[model samples]
Target chain A: MRNLIDVTDLSVAEIDELIATAEDMIAEPDKYAQVCRGKQLATLFFEPSTRTRLSFESAMLSLGGSVLGFSEANSSSTAKGETVGDTVHTVSCYVDIVAMRHPKEGAPYAAAQYSEVPIINAGDGGHNHPTQTLTDLLTIHREKGRLDNLTVGFCGDLKFGRTVHSLVNALSRQKGINFVFISPEELKMPAYIKENTLDKNGLSYEETASLEEAMPKLDILYMTRVQKERFFNEADYIRLKDTYVLDPEKLETAKKDLCILHPLPRVNEISIAVDSDPRACYWKQVKNGKFIRMALIMKLLELQL
Target chain B: MKIDSIQDGVVLDHIKAGKSMDIYKYLHLDKLDCSVAIIKNVRSGRLGKKDIIKIDSPMEVDLDVLGYIDPDITVNIIRNGVRVEKKHLALPEKLVNVIHCKNPRCITTAESQLPAIFLLSDAQKRSYRCAYCEAEKTRRV
Candidate 1:
């Protein structure tokens, strides 16, 4: 693929290739350290993102490549009414690749149309973050040694969670994957997603309000924070924010080998007391984000392992 | 009474009732120098009531846009007062810049110069989704 705009952009074989490349990077980090030497990566983040932006920069630095570009739109020519197409055209002339994060959905996609180099969407509003999907895939493959035949339960905020949607889109294509959506009625999975991604693919899934009821049967429990920013009213956010907290009491009913994951910068969705649990692989997910990004960068740049 | 047929022009038939005005405005037919007539609420055998637009000059009309607005529309090409060709339409596989994407966070909203593109996702529901952001196109016109 020329660009990483969405999780669906990568085929099943390509995803497996990326996972294999990431595993190779983990085993022999030094061997691939200088693969991107003398190259440049431009990180054009129009929105505020600490983890994604830093991980992209770290990934490039570890590959012996340099990183450049602004962290916010106000600091760049975008403040002067420069369009994303113009910025991408100009920046692609200077950099080998671009990792862009914007508050506008499909900003990187617009940029990709004009960019000569590959465009990696770090996070585009709530549309997609394919790199994070890659990170989750690698983490899952490492934890369970397979990506198929797993009963995965997505807990909390299925309605507005872009990561959940992207991961679900990717996982639905795999064989023997069943989804158990655990969320409040107000935050149920969108109808288009259920109809297009799941139903069209003939995937089996069930929806429920109680996470505890779906816990014992889950092989993987993906937890997401109910963001206050997504709600129009503060009272509604306050009322629904604490609906699905993954505490020790809740974990008691879960499977012994259940892998728990969260795309972090989390606002108390998963309790701090559960951090020491063997199944809590979110911290490892963060580290895997960097490694998988490294693998992706190398793949996009067409560098051999 | 019978409407005068054009010698060499285009005839849009089977338009849903009360929708010819939208098609006329959407196609910018008023800006054309040639004569254009809109026949609204006309009786039809296939439809209870339909609208027809007759243009007295040959010009390229966007069939995809017409399909998006009303897929049941049929376009008849007239030459020398004879019906030369008939064109039937289905929901287009893709549309370019025909409808504005209402999603606030869509890239086309941020980049004004970029054309709004949508792909037909569901034919049964006649649904189109933005090619960039995957937001469903809510506004039909």
Candidate 2:
């Protein structure tokens, strides 16, 4: 009955458990290879998300579970005027679990209502992508060795980045967390997030425009792209697209062990030169993304450890 | 200016002036075959000017519509030509179909069959968000 529509749906202990399970999966890949044998996963992607869809399929396949379902609305019954509930209800009758991604916000949540099996929200428009947050959390925990008492700086488009919102929400529950948000005034983190999470808990945080100005003090640097899809005006998108480009020069003032992370498909926001730095862990985030999803699939299905 | 009192119906009092029509429309008073009177801009000692709605039938009203439109309003249930219960309204925790989600990216926009559910996200500010999309909507009327 449990469905992950938002990162907040998982508690601190549950998140720790998921991270632990993910770490164990990384350690012993052979142990979980056949855990999901004979089980099926339905990837009900109503949008085209190549990396995310592939990652879910790869994760299920790694668990020896077969994958089925569509990649876009045009290829499915949705194109034939079928509702999401009808499609998911029909798909759930055949599959053991469901992984859904849709362009409209809350489609996955709506699917969970009609689905007989457990539902995992892959990504829902710009609203929520909890699995991405899990990947980020796993990356941070593996790199930093802890999740609390460290300064986390979020850069770039904090406004529309669901990853930033989910991560901030997850991190806010931890003890002694300091947040430094770096973005232009137009792209600052939403006030509701600050008011409801950080300020409500009395957590310390500061806002600045320059990433370099906040770099030296950060323990974890999370960068995000200024998504063109979120902006309605082409002029606004063009003006803010090149706002912050993180290159090697920007990392000169950063700490050596700073865990630099980005949710990828980068278009020059992260310079190619920064890839060689030991602190840059965005690649590892991709690797961890699969394992954590495997753990999440296992957890939601209540499969054996 | 006097209106006949109902025998076994409901009286909505203390509605903020000029908000009676919205409440009437939301409550679907126009569709009712029974007597429904919307008295507007009535002089009040406390509110200065307020609106009242009198329903002649013993039909139930949507409390959420009344609450969201004007929570300051009071409700009186009349039974057998006598006052039965006087109820004061407060902002409801959830609203279903009282208002629609304006966000174009919301799932409710495409699926017209889906119930339009909005949750009271911020009570003090009277802010509601679509249950599906979490799109913030402030009080419109």
**Candidate 1 chain B, poorest ten consecutive residues by summed lDDT:** B1-10
What does candidate 2's lDDT look like per residue over A98-150, in tens digits?
99999889898888889999989998887888999999999999998999999
TM-score of chain B of 2: 0.93
Model 1, residue pairs in steric clash: none
List native contact recovery per candidate, as a fraction of 1. 0.85, 0.77
lDDT of 1 by residue, A181-207 (tens): 999999899898999999998999999
User: Looking at candidate 1, what is the lDDT of residue B51?
Assistant: 92
TM-score of each: 0.95, 0.95
Residue pairs with backbone atoms closer than 3 Å in model 2 (clashes)? none
Docking class of 2: medium
Model 1 clash tally? 0
Q: lDDT score, residue A42, model 2?
A: 92
Error of 1 at A93 (Å): 1.3
